[model samples]
Target: MVTDRRSEFEATLTRTAEARGQEAGAALQRASLLRDAIHRFIRNRAAVVAAVAFVVMVGFVILTPWLSHGSAYGVDFAQAYKSPSWAHPFGTDEFGRDLLVRTALGGRVSIAIGFAATIAIMIVGILYGAISGFAGGRIDDMLMRFLDALYGLPYLPFAIITLAIFGTVNFWTMVVALTIASWFTTARVMRGQIITLKENDYVRAANALGARWYRVLFRHLLPNTLGVILIFVFLELPGVVLGEAFLSFIGLGISPPKASWGTLAQDGYSAYEAHPYIIIIPSLAIAWLILSAFFVADGLRDALDPRTRET
Candidate 1:
């Protein structure tokens, strides 16, 4: 009886050791993958430059207003349309507001809206898609049909309607307007990924082990889809920025006295002929940000793709 008990104890010990070994191996593998992805991203020179430029631009926008100790709303007609000089590098706008300060402030608003809306989009899309895909029956069909219906709605017009319903067009309102229709694409992509991933052996094993639905979804499914999520975030940012800019340009976004890149461009539109730099500076800022975002997204795509990972 003692011998039998010892034998059982040994078997338990062996199983425990094997489990630890497997867990350690998985941890190492994950670390190696992350390291390789970073290396790949660093090797892409344009992406590296773009990432740096984006960080610099963000810092500039955030700090410029604070360091200048100036209000974006401050206007002085006497200094109106002053040419770029020692006092104001970007010159003055039609209202005689400092273009540099206003441009920086505008960037803050635009970038903030983009990020806030993108986060909201990701949260809604991920949860909806994950649940739908995992359920995989009438529920999936219903959810997908609803998403399809949303897809038919025109993006800008829908946003306009959303803003109208809120009876205001401000930061949070813009985020909601952008998030409403924009999440459809993300949901579709995530749903497709979840469907494919749910059939994997590990996922099946997780289910067989009686893990909770939320645990399986968050730990096993969503973790595996990180690559897709990261790529989508960078790709979506530029669209959100542009959308906010477009709405603001049309007088439905951030109101006057509050600056946004779109509003700055709108403010400068009529004066472009006599003072072309007013429009040119803000437009250039928008173009640079979009280009940088795209390059970073491309780099992340290549880095995270197993097929493209360097051996």
Candidate 2:
């Protein structure tokens, strides 16, 4: 009797603990849903601020050329290397072209290149990561080996070789270079996330319900991972911009006649003794753009992390 009573007591205790755990889990889920909703609803007031700044910056870069009466390329010996004045704000370069116009054009190229490269990286990363993670086993092993092989190679050397063979840094080439060099990092992060997500109860339940593989992967897995993906994308932009600028700085980027922040900076630095405005203006623009992206990204990192609010 004593033994039977002891076993019954133990079982009752176990059931009581499990019941409390379920309740706690439900409470936690409700709290998490509430927090996520609040974060979305507010939309990071800081990001809203950044959205405004980004809009103004984009407008200035894209619209100023159309708005101005004179062309960016129009040269006047009289205005060559002139100081910033009421008539010619941002001054003129060595060729007497409008510094304002060149800088604006440069901004357009830098931002555009960054956007293109980042998109390509994200697409490749998402597909590669999701597929490998879901398939797992030998397929995952083979795919990861390929990824590791690429990662093992020296990146800068590879970039230099690829650019040298291509012999141009036009729009497509720039996109290719950035995409090739950058996607691995995204792929690794995404693979880890997929591994964690694929094991979730909902994903298993979907599989058990006879849902098709593609539908389950896309409808259930992708949507759930979007928040994480978005955060990474924003974080990646600054790195992309910096890479474009560095490539341009080294003369391996968007070639002359087309301006990029790096090319502009290169020109400015070379002529610094004679033309201070050229370097100073473009450099400042690059600084501002980078800073704006970084600040917004930082705010997002803080707000999006689930543990942040809990702590």
Candidate 3:
């Protein structure tokens, strides 16, 4: 009787523990999984500084122009080449327009292009990669082959060629060109991630439970891959902005009256001997924006890395 009672007591304790686990598993899992990442990200000094700087820069670029009555294109030859002052803090360009206003407007355009292209690229690449990875076999082979063909093409030259053929690259045209050139990387990354994840025990369990292919891919595989994708997204933006600026600098980006940082810098370069501030200001803006993005990406990678989670 004593031995039987002891066995029953142990069984009762096991049952009680399982019941408590079932009640709190989700909450515990969520906190355990996310808390470390969040804490690490918050503790990153450079990342926090960069984040604040980026937000401030973007807001100043966008709101400064709107807050004032100055036109980015308004010419005042009388005030030409005036150095930084209260009337023109960034000074006057060759056209005698307020450099501050023009630079801010340029920032607006450059950042917009960066964000729009990244978003489009992410959506297309994720879908293509998820489909290719989850539906492995001949279908996967064909899709990957197609991706390879696109990936092998020269991105910069092809974008230039497309712009030349079109003869009128507007905002939408540039967005499309950048999207086409950039999505290949995301597709490659996502495909590899999904393929490995699909073989994991959790994924296998979901499949065994009669989850549809689409559900498994989108609901399970996709979310798991998002941390990597998001990190890449920020990392890609700086490159996109730089590429757009380079094109604009060469006279191929969005045409005049619609200034980009590249155009602003290019214009500033014309009278550079007399007024270097014009060029200097826009160049500083670009560097700051790109560096800030890199800082954030580094922070994100550190936060999400499982190896670093314990620290």
Candidate 4:
């Protein structure tokens, strides 16, 4: 038996050697920045867990219709106001719609709005902030003053007033309202970061080399600020989701049959005294997701920040 084992080991080693001999040697490749970031991100256990949880919840939302009664919009007079039970896990709404289905659908809409608004914010905010910071002097002064003026205005009231002026609301309108309200901080943060980076030697060198200001900002500065930007994205998503919910709750957001979490919460609120689960379930879903987003943001900040790497 020992002799057979030795022979098998020798055969395995021989096979390995032959395979290596058959393969051509190549130059070692330099590590990529993106690869390094991925490695660092994976190493952050909290971030990974949060991201996994978030993904699973999203998957659950996507698959809920298939997994359950499979009808988000279908009203069943039979199941009206039913509490958590084997048939309907999340209970039913006043319209006899499945609460589980409605909540999942609401989550989808809420998450979509959050991401959409974030994208809008990132585009306008990053550009506005970068330009403001890079230009400095009078242009920066003017922009900063304008932003400050916008800041002093009562925010939610302004949004409510704007929505009222329009007289009718929908998903797109809600997203636009949220984006318009929420992008100020991102711009301010980006401007501050760009201002700090503007005087750096590399930025000056890029400018001296006749590289366009935009090119320098995009290529050299943005990459360096990516860590902060990504962290901001995670942190901002929850706020946007909550804001959409708030607007919808107040009837200033997506109206009628198109339900977001806010609308569901509003619908749930009326009967909550009698059937608490209807409201509680959607509320918990929102809270859990927002908390998960915060955890991801915190983890990303710690993992991605070069300044924090040494610690």
Model 1 gets an lDDT of 0.87
Flag clash pairs in model 4: none
**Model 3, stretches more than 4 Å misplaced?**
1-31
Cα deviation of 266, candidate 1, in Å: 0.6
Estimate the TM-score of every prediction. Answer: 0.91, 0.83, 0.88, 0.85
User: Tens-digit lDDT track for model 4 on 1-311?
Assistant: 99999998998777555434322111011124445567777888888999998998899778887778645677778768888787878878877888887888888889998999898988888989999998999999999999999898776776677666667787777777777887899999999999997776656655655678778788777766776788899988998888888888877666667788888888888887898887788788888889889999988877666555443
Tens digit per residue, CA lDDT, model 3, 110-223:
999999999998999988988888888999999999998987788887778777777788887888788878898888888899899888655665565566888778766787
Candidate 3 TM-score versus the reference: 0.88
lDDT of 2 by residue, 52-91 (tens): 6767878888998777654477778887888898767888
lDDT of 4 at 141: 96
Q: What is the lDDT of candidate 3?
A: 0.84
Off by over 4 Å in 2: 1-49, 309-311
As for lDDT, the candidate ahead, 1 or 2, is 1
lDDT of 4 at 237: 94
lDDT of 1 by residue, 131-181 (tens): 899889999999999998888999999999999999998899999999995
Candidate 1 is scored at a TM of 0.91
* Candidate whose TM-score is highest: 1
Ranking by TM-score: 1, 3, 4, 2
TM-score of 4: 0.85
